[model samples]
Target chain A: MENKMGYNASFAEEVFRNVDSGDEIKMCMNCGVCAASCPLREHMDYPPRQIFSLIRAGKREEVLGSQSIMLCTSCYTCVVKCPRSIPVMDVMHGLAHYALKKGYTPRIEAARFGKEFWNQVYRRGRVDERDLAQRAYFAGGFWEGVKKILEFADVGIKLVLHRRMKLIPEKKIKGISTLRKMLDKAEMLDKGRSVQ
Target chain B: MADVQTTNQSILVVGGGMSGITSALEAAEAGYDVVLVEKNPYLGGRVAQLYQYFPKLCPPNCGLEINFRRMRQNSKIRFFTMAEVANISGSEGNYNVTIKLSPRYVNDKCTCCGKCSDACEAEIDNTFNFGMDKIKAAYLPHEFAFPMRYVIDPSIVETEDGKKCQEVCEYGAIELDMAESTFDLNVGAVVWAAGWNPYEAEKIDYYGFGEYPNVITNVMMERMASPNGPTQGKILRPSDGKEVKNIAFIQCAGSRDENHLPYCSGICCLASMKQATYVRERHPDCDISIFFIDIRALDRLEDFYTKVQEDEKIQFIKSKIANISEDEATGNLLLEGENTRTGEQLRMTFDMAVLATGMVPNKIDIAGAPEVAADEYGFVINDPEKAGIYGAGCVRRPTDVASSVADATSSAFKAIQSIARR
Candidate 1:
């Protein structure tokens, strides 16, 4: 396949600069151990190693559009086994957050999951599993919801057993406005708009 | 005769693994008398288990042969196999040590023939073989095993059957009547090179290491890839003995987590990649996927990673596997993980799964000597103030063979310097 290239020098600089953990990204040996160790690597459009390579090569559009970065579990196995101890998981998560800010359409499942989680946190100030599940099923669109409902019984039994099967939403806790403010900040960040 | 008196002193090298061998050789070559004690019946340590060393094609025998030869010729370097330093006392310039040597039953006179193995009725897991295969009660450790001698595992050898092997042997090499003995020696310094054990995978239940047949550790993969191994270097699934088509290597199975060992066991990444290359070479059609948080191929090793990636058969994935289950009938490994980029949780199947387990320091109970300080990760801390002891190889920290050797040499130099100054 021919390599598609795009450059985002400023964004790349921003990512490198904003990483909380002090690690040198340039030292990556690209052994693909991270990708290999990643539990979700098989489903990603581009593995962790390729994402780094693309980011380094200035392929911002390809990276943003790629479905791989959004699937990170943040399990930190790669961070731990990293011979150079690169903050790879965090970097990928940060990049995924960056992509979300742009107008890029998130893969259906993750986008709906994210929206449901946000709504739960926004409306109830905490996650109400039943509400979140219903919202998630509806927001993800029809066929997806039907497909999920087919498997929901198995999932619902476990959730019920764990006392997570709540029908009545809890009274809105004290943190809704604070959560809304955080969401607004996140939305702004997601849009590539500067956040003070 | 000279104004500056250089005292002739003996140094005790504990655990004849890589670091111990290096320390003993360096100190002995420096004209100091050395006593190397190994709990196992042979030297060469973990390196002997490996088929090949990375970056260099040198087999374990290539380096070990020279060291073994040096030990043979050097009278000053008195060594003991199946020996443990039971008690150690005194300070750096002068120290007393009591060593307990276990009975070998078969002595120096025994020729390494297949007779004893055939005669012996007892069978046990060969620790040297990484327990993938079995060995007779009377067996040699490995092909190019140091000392080039066979040992009897007294624990497994039945008293009645043991006599049968002794009677069958034409050569009077079998000495079932031998007894364990202890000896006291004076030494100037001590080098603790106990090495490391692979972090136990039992704790990481999510990986299904013990629960699933196809889920094996990286060390197991090493044995599987070795020509002298159980499968004779064939990468096949343990569940069905079918040739592995899709292999998934999970990096950092137990290391680099606050709940387990927090430090990276330096070589797991390179080891996994090397195994991937091994599989790619052996079975061109095999689909190899490595799931990891990052690709940590430092220095020129990055080139090797790139080369491996260029192979279409190998795929790299960036995600940490949170769960692994087995498909009961097929024994195919079901792995669940989140693809960070797409924010999607994914499920995949593999014929076999290899967990890149990290290293834990070898468990040794040293008595009478000052306690050796180790980090939370169980790696030895080398503070000269603490009993004047030094640690080398994996004991000091998790390192590759090159780094381990370098660390051993530096540790030897430091040990020699300490003795010389005194």
Candidate 2:
């Protein structure tokens, strides 16, 4: 075992100096509030509390590669109820973004669904069910999309009959620039390029 | 004639922490006679523990210094440090309070000389340092501590050294012999701003705070990261004294759990994110991760979370740690849990861990204090219409410093209304 005596004075000083308002990371008292309240705790490799420790200890790559972050639905259940108000969902999303950008393949099916959703939203002004379904199927893989194509035929026919399906894609919204700007800003902030 | 009426016109403010101090200052400044009672030896509360505050660059000393000056200048605000309200009688604007004050071996006459500290032969865990460092029996709470005085801990003071401390002190500030005293006062209104204690880690054995040397709490992290703290503001593993390469922040350690505090303590999530940023800023090469169930950023706080996410050095995981154990040889932390989204179980290791403990109300139960009501969680129940009896800061609900100050100001306005009605 390591001699639990010395501390890093320079590192601590630097933390004190550079730690901004959002950087109010604290020490874990080992209370299991995060794990107990986590809606996705049952599915995570390392629960919220452990994830925090990993971050504090500077294990960023391991946490980014972990599948635990991809499972978070961003429900804000833990955040609303956290006694410490640690922004669990925000942290999870931040890690997911990092992992995705770093080329860490998400092991969760839900993540693929989210990627499809994002792509749909980015490419098209509005989400169309047929387009979304097609995109989701394709993104999931060719075999999975092909296998689901038969199941989707029934719904596709109904949508066409009801005129709910758009054949040529809707007109681009006028506020796309603003939306792009906001998304870009969010991405930049999530990447920690600029402070709010 | 009418029933004999006792004019208990004094207002008693309990728990001389930041909220309590604000409440006392606000009420006293309104020209009401106030009696402020503190459980600790000093007046400044958790805010004093912080190295620096958010939204503003002001240190705890900067804001607290102003409050201290106001407290000293306002004679109407009578305060007792190391005191607690033993019992209470009467109701709304007519409370008879008995305050039991613990002894402070040093009196007001002594200057802040190091004689008592030097002469004393006692060492104990410094609560001010969050137990990271030892302190002499005779010591100042912290740098720029209010009253600028040194205190001798009777619990640790040796009999022979206690005498020597008195002899060495030129100003005669050391009082080896002191007694706990009880005093009674009548008050017209009472503001119970008794703040919160970080949820104890022992309750949740999964995180292994007491069992693991590297596993600490958010409060301990605050002290560890504070410039005035034990390490002089260094982030290192407690077990090996090695520079931390990987750190993890576990949020909602004792909060938002049905088995513990079901309600959100309100600040843990932001606090962890802020701490992550702290680590990243200090050790650019260091890797940081935050595990949380959700990111509960209400309104503008979402922006803050977004900003933290942008730091490439920091990572966030959306899992609640189900188990934690220390590696016997390396002192590294081993954590295990399932990835809900992927339906896969995983494990990882880290140099140190932090549990984001929640807050619990100080007043678990109080008799004869019917004028004040508490929620199911024991937080002081706030009535927007009620006058005089005001709840501010964490006592009312979990909030950040800015929100707590706003609550104090609002409570002050309500108190003003009550006095104006008189």
Candidate 3:
């Protein structure tokens, strides 16, 4: 955690120019309403409002490495309740994405799960629930994955019985190629500039 | 009263608040004919509702009394209560104004005797107290109300209880049949001193203002502390009438926020500090916390901020309260937020919470009125070249009482200048 108190705007400027909707943080008055409104605030090491405060104070490593960035469920309560009308959810998700790209794995499990989820959508036009769940469970390693799957054995059985998960192998949708082309274009655009 | 003589050299001052009264009095004292109109049944406006002013902490009545006395003695100033400018036409030195007058129900013969209210059984929300209590349908606006007259609620005019009130009036002041009327005025200049309305606290859902009984706005707190207030000057929790041992003053409730009043209200910080004294005066040991993003004491008022800072019981938290939730068991409030200075999350409970809500400018929407442009936030803009039309006081911008008086004086001077040019 970079605790140097003197304001260094270099990192803030970088985040503003590079992070998606990062410029919106400039409007924050540090009112703490976003943090209070956040349902996941208690679980966060640095709540949404505090994260913005840290960002402005030039705590670049602390902000990027904080697990709070990856915990956004995107319920959008902060965005709607923000008096400044800041896109708080977008900023958090943007920071999370930016952190991963910068090689800071704050929450490795969350990053792995996200990568797998994205891969599923890219490979198959739609996510195969059963296949995605197994892939996510196994990401930590085979033995630990088995233990985690065992912990959710009843949920898995219930899912299969409810017909929410198919026993057969998943099939790619008819328009998989078109979807892949659109995703590729999105990636290309993302690489060129931040997409709100 | 209908034949209020006015001409091309006369000034028409809209609103009867401190600003309007000052504008009218200043112009009239300068020997210019001035006509003052107020939508309320009496003058004083929002200032009348305040328990006391900041810095000096003197009662608003003292200032209001002087203005009322000046208004009463000024022969050049003709004033009307329960009146509004319905329309304005022409320009500069030749403006024709149509004034809408709502019936007072009780005529000038009113002795302000409490008999009518005594005989009246019909009750209505006492807006003077921000509807914190109920009053007889026929009652005075307040004890210090100018004109010292009684007004009858239109809802009870045709009811039997209203008839009883009319019969009990020995002075024959009750005129239940009084009808709404309109009249015309010719003026050289128009000064819109239409004051401000308290920003709707209920709109900020996170504060739980309307949802929580103990949570009230700063304006309501003024009334709560006033001798003539709903609780008769008792600072008691609304739910159980228990004296508050701990109170929270949440500053900038709806001010300085993009979703609310984006402009800083300029007075709320000092107002909250002044109110903290009200709590400490009643209960010396009472705990008071003022939550604010920043303390905008500004200019000379910084001394008052220092004085408040000296009080150990009154703590100033450098954080905007995130939200407030009520403890249904005790009707106490739990305020949630982070102390921005320490980066520590806070969840403190208080006996009551006062939301330092900001002021919203009253809408100047008179049909046929001269073009007076307002800023994006609806504060009337002062255009130097907009002929004789002028905006003053809170209507033009959020200001303290002293600043409002000064702004109103300037408007009066401008109005006189416009008339002199004519």
Tens-digit lDDT string for candidate 2 (B198-290): 999888776898889999998888788888888777888888888889988887787877657888888899888877766776677888888
Quote model 3's iRMS. 1.3
Best by lDDT: 3
Docking class of 1: incorrect
Any runs in candidate 1 off by more than 4 Å, and if so which?
A1-196, B1-8
Docking class of 3: medium
Cα lDDT, all candidates? 0.78, 0.74, 0.90
Candidate 3 C-alpha lDDT tens digits along A39-149: 898899999888897888888899999999999999998998787999999999999999999999999988888889999999987788888878888998999789988
- DockQ winner between 1 and 3, please give it: 3
Candidates in order, TM-scores: namely 0.70, 0.67, 0.96
Q: Name model 2 segments beyond 4 Å from true.
A: A1-196, B1-7, B156-158, B384-388, B416-422
TM-score of 3: 0.96
Worst 10 residues of 1 chain B by lDDT: B1-10
lDDT value, residue B413 of candidate 3: 95
